[model samples]
Target: MKIVNAKEAGEQEIERLLTKAAFDQVELNPKIREANRKLFGRDMSAAELVRQIVRDVRNEGDKAVIHYTELIDRVRFTPEDFLVTEEEFQAAKDEADPDVVASLQKAAENVRRYHQEQKPKSWMTYRDAGSILGQAIIPLDRVGIYVPGGTAAYPSSVIMNAMPAVVAGVREIIMMVPPKNGKINPYVLVAARAAGIKKIYKIGGAQAIAAMAFGTETIPRVDKITGPGNIFVTLAKKEVYGHVDIDMLAGPSEILILADKTADPVYTAADMLSQAEHDPLASSIVITDDAGLAERVAKELEKQLADLPRREIAQASLDRNGLIVIAEDMRQALHFANVSAPEHMELLTEQPFQLLPYVRHAGAVFLGAYSPEPLGDYFAGPNHVLPTGGTARYYSVLNVETFMKRTSIISYTQPALSDVSSDIIRLAETEGLQAHANAIRLRRK
Candidate 1:
């Protein structure tokens, strides 16, 4: 990692670095334009596939869903197997480690409690002339939570995805994860059941997303899909977006630590590696004002990486995207951090609270060295599903709001219409919208 002084980078360099690049260009500079020519650049091949699946499911319903599930997942299952029963959930819950079950139970509770505070309430106002306006927040009838099943059973995702829907009062929460040899992970199953999820399907990848979006024989259609997955799954979600609402097009996990000389090297190192172990594409960087502190943190990172079980993966990520930028001062450090808009931002400074006001963009912010990013991932009360690949500048971490929709209500009485009719007609006519002008003009009398 090179320690570059932000002031020396120049305004042009800063602009180039800070500007959000296309999603594919984050870690590597690919010959994408060339590659696209070879592989049909910027086309809707994926979208076409999702459209076909949706049509099949919409027309054929359950039978089409089952056929796709069999073709895609290669797992044969009846409808009974799709919806996990209370007995099956209990068995999975019982089979899990007592300590792990306890931990997951606690994590689910904390997640639910935090999201409960985020629940939107319905409000309305009525005027003396009988004009009324309001907003009604309504949860989706059914929601699908996709948990990655095969490689590592992400029980944390279960809590992060399902708890918000639960808090938002979503009626039916369905879960789909790829089955390992046709069986779901006991821990994942237990966690889902604990998080108030009523359904679990053994499917994964783009096929799983397709099923959720289109609703095959075994899986019912979901109003929205929420969770993380691999490139194919992510791309599938991106493709099927309009057919069903999606949380976000998540990329590889990332963490940016903004620390001062007073920050702990050990904690910073550990936090950086947390995202690094997720995947080689995952990025971990630190912005600091002290060069010596950067060196210390880099040394600690190397030392810590050596001992980690996923050292090879973490090392690859650190070697490629990881950086320690030494800024001229704290102001420059914060400026760089905002431009990056990392998925996870940790303020490991002497005064984390004081520095927080300057943070313009980040999916989630961890205050103080003790508040590690992983605390939000598992045991802490915040959602771990955050925007990645610089989308944090506009997107937010998954919350209860993600699972619900808002509808605006407006009612204008004769008096209200009389008050604003002439203004409305004038504005409409100015825009050459005669029909709009006539609509208001007719009501004026």
Candidate 2:
């Protein structure tokens, strides 16, 4: 990791350092191109490939879904094999360890209780003259959650994505995961069951996204789709956005730590490595005013990296994206953090709450030394599906509201209409909407 003095760096250099590594801006290396050529006999970008896959699944339905599943994943599937059977669910339950099952159940309860507080209720307010006006919150009919599968399965993702929808009273929660050797992960199945999701499809990749966006013969279309995936899956969600609602176009995982003299180097290094081990594209950064602390943290990272099972991946991530900056003071550190708008921000100051007021942008903030990013990812009640790639400036963490729709309620008695008819007609007429004015005029008459 490289260390730089933030105050000495030029403004242009600072801006460049803060910019995120966006997928659209990335170029495929020769290795990736060769692999693509071997698989599809063409060198196509992720976006182009996703476009073709989404188009095929939208038009050909189940046939195209099966074809792509076989082609990409090398797993042949019959239509009957698409939906997970009750037998599979029971088998998963039986196969899962009792301790792991208990942990998932406890995590599910924590997630449920947290999101239950966010559930919106249908409310109405009465105005003068018996007029009623308020907002009505309605749950979506159905939703699809994409769980990444193949090398590893994320049961925590299932809990985080499904619990919010369940809390919001969504009629149906459908989950999709790619099968490995014609089998889904038992832990993922158990997590889905714990989250109250019954509909799970044995599929993965952009094809799964397309199948959910446009209803296939076996898979039902959903009002919204939520989850994180690889670049292909992210591109598919981007393409299918107009057809179906999506949470956010997620990017690689990232975390930024703002530390001071009181911060522990060991804990800071461990937290940074936690996110770095996630993927080669993941970013981990630290900004601190103490040069001694910065050096200690850097040394600790090197020591800890030796023991991680995913050391190669974490090393690549740290080499490419990790940085330690020496800020003149805590104020400068906080300024850079807000500008970065990282997915996860941690404050390791003596008084973390004192710095909380300075946090204007961050998907999730972990305060104090004990609160690590992984805590929010699993055991914590808060959703771990956070906005990434500087989108925290506008987007939010996935919550119960993501699975709901709000309708404006408006009611007016004759006197109420009479009270505003002239103003309404004038506004409509100013906009050259004579029909709108006429409708109001006729109603008043």
Instruction: Indicate which candidate wins on lDDT.
Output: 2
lDDT of 1 by residue, 186-253 (tens): 99988887887777877676667877887866678899999998765787788778999999999888
Highest TM-score, which number? 2
Model 1 has an lDDT value of: 0.82
Off by over 4 Å in 1: 1-87
Q: Residues 45-159, candidate 2: write the lDDT tens digits.
A: 7777889999999999999999989998889998999999999999999999999999999999999999999988888999887789999999999999999884457999999
lDDT of 1 at 349: 93
Listed in order, each prediction's TM-score against the native is 0.87, 0.98
Candidate 1 displacement at residue 61 in angstroms: 7.1
Cα error of candidate 2 at position 161, Å? 0.2
| Candidate 1 TM-score over all chains jointly | 0.87
